[model samples]
Each structure stands twice: as C-alpha cells, then as structure tokens.
Target: MGKWSNQINGRGNWSFTKYIYDNLYNFQWINRENNEIEDNLILTKSISLERVEQYIYFKDIFKGEYFSKLLEIPEALEELKIHMPEGYKTKEDIIDVINSRALNPNLKALDMSLPTHLNFVLISLNLPPHEGEVNDPMEYIVDALEKKYTKEENN
Candidate 1:
C-alpha cells in the first residue's frame, strides 16, 4: 500500500486525500473521438503553488449544471461515473453515512474544504505520470467536462 493521509471532514469521516505533491504539468485540448489525431503539444512546466491555485480557480470557473447537486453523496457518485472514464467506480459504501452526516453543522462548516466519497474514485484510479510528463490523468477529466458544460450552459 502507498502512504496515505487521512483528514477528518466536517462529519468526522476520514477523507483520504492521496497525492504525490511533485513537479507535474498537465493540459487538456479538444479532439474528435475515434479519429486518428496527432498531438505534439506539451503543457509541462514547473508551476508554483500559486499557479496551482490559479489552475484550480480556472478549473472551477467551468462548472457543470449538475455540479452543485453532487454534494449529495448519491448524486456525486453518479456524477463521478458520468464524468470519469470507465473502469473507475466510486465506493458507495460510505454514501449513507455521509448523507446522514451532511446534516451536521460541523460538517457544513468544513464542507468547502472537504472531500466527499466521490473523491475516492479519483484517488482509487491512481493515474500517474505518462510520456515523460508527470501530470495526473484525472485532471483531464475536469477539462473534458468543462467544455461540455460550457457549451451546455451557453446554449
């Protein structure tokens, strides 16, 4: 097993946030599916924590219509399945307990910084650096959904 860090969220259930905080670069672009395409672009460069924050902000700006509903455990799991690529599944085992605890004031207070069970789905994938690049594949997921979301919201 890899090293893990467990932090209690508002309801006190442990949020297992696993990541190798390292020099990583990632970028996502548009493409046609099932068509032969060549990508020679690289989005790699050493970025500061501030840049990560900027990326996260830029990331959050393109929110999906169903995003807010995902705070509810079941909705979140379903959203994960839809948003994420196949072979990865969120652990439903904690849904009931998490939903129940969502009513707690403490959890509510800490909700903004908390990771729900759906987060585990990404953690479970354990995607790593590829092609001499160390970017997390999961990050591409956000980019993919954001484009769809933007088109949807604009229409």
Candidate 2:
C-alpha cells in the first residue's frame, strides 16, 4: 500500500484502496468488454493522494450546469471540482455528471452501462463517512483540506 492508504484504511465497509489494488489494469488503455477506454484511463496503481487532490482541486473545470447545484454549498463550490475521466469526454462528445452532482469519482469504472451509485470520490481527499457525518462526499472535503493543512504545518 502507498502512503495515502495509511489514513483511509476504513472507508465505510469498502476500502477504496483495495478496490484500486484489485482493479488495477496493466495496460493504460484497453477495451474492457462493455466499455471502450479511448483516452488513457487513470492508471489505478499510479493513484496517490496528491494526484487525486490535483484531479479534484484543479484538473477538470466544472461546467455551469453542475456548478449551479454546487451553489448550494458555496464553500465547496469554491474549492472542489470533479475529476473527468480521460476519454470520457471530448470537445465533440462529452458525457459528464451534468445532470446531477452525484459525486462519484470513478465515473464509469464500475460500468457505464450500469446505473450510477454516487460514491463521491471520498478516498482521494482523505475524508470519511465518519460514523454519523453527513455522508455526502462534498461535505467531507473541508475535513480533508484541513487535515492536509494540519499535516503540512507539522511537517
């Protein structure tokens, strides 16, 4: 396991780290039966806290449609942005969670043909379901940022 896994060993009955470990594909791009990963899909093994943070905080610009819902959480709207899986979108044809902010990070990894479960990219940010905390992925982002800053200060 990598360094990030240390902080998130218990993730609501589903270890996201284990999921990545189990599902990591050797090839960068492969047509996995039901889906065709045209662009370089995220090499699951290469995933780290820094990379996941980068993808969430800076990589993909939020569309106005999605940002509209984000308006409900002004602070989160300012900080978090969704990670657009490579090849999932193109200038010509893009299919994003524009309909609703489901907060699922692994866009179609589970299977696009299947339904979306709104997993909300929690592991990367070092956030948690935290027993009784509001289970929304966006809700824990503040906690993740605070934790990162706290660690940085100590370091």
The candidate maximizing lDDT is 2
All-Cα superposition RMSD per candidate: 17.7, 17.7
lDDT of each: 0.38, 0.39
lDDT of 1 by residue, 1-155 (tens): 12332323332222222234543333222233422122222223344322222223222322333343454668666765665435545544333333344335544433333233324443454422223331433355465457656877999
Residue pairs of candidate 2 with colliding backbone atoms: 103-120
The ten-residue window of minimal lDDT in model 1 covers 34-43
Query: How well is each residue in 91-132 modelled by candidate 2, as lDDT tens digits?
Result: 222234443356444443433422222234444445453444
Q: Note the residue pairs that clash in candidate 1.
A: 10-107
In candidate 2, position 74 carries an lDDT of 52
Cα shift from native, residue 125, model 1 (Å): 16
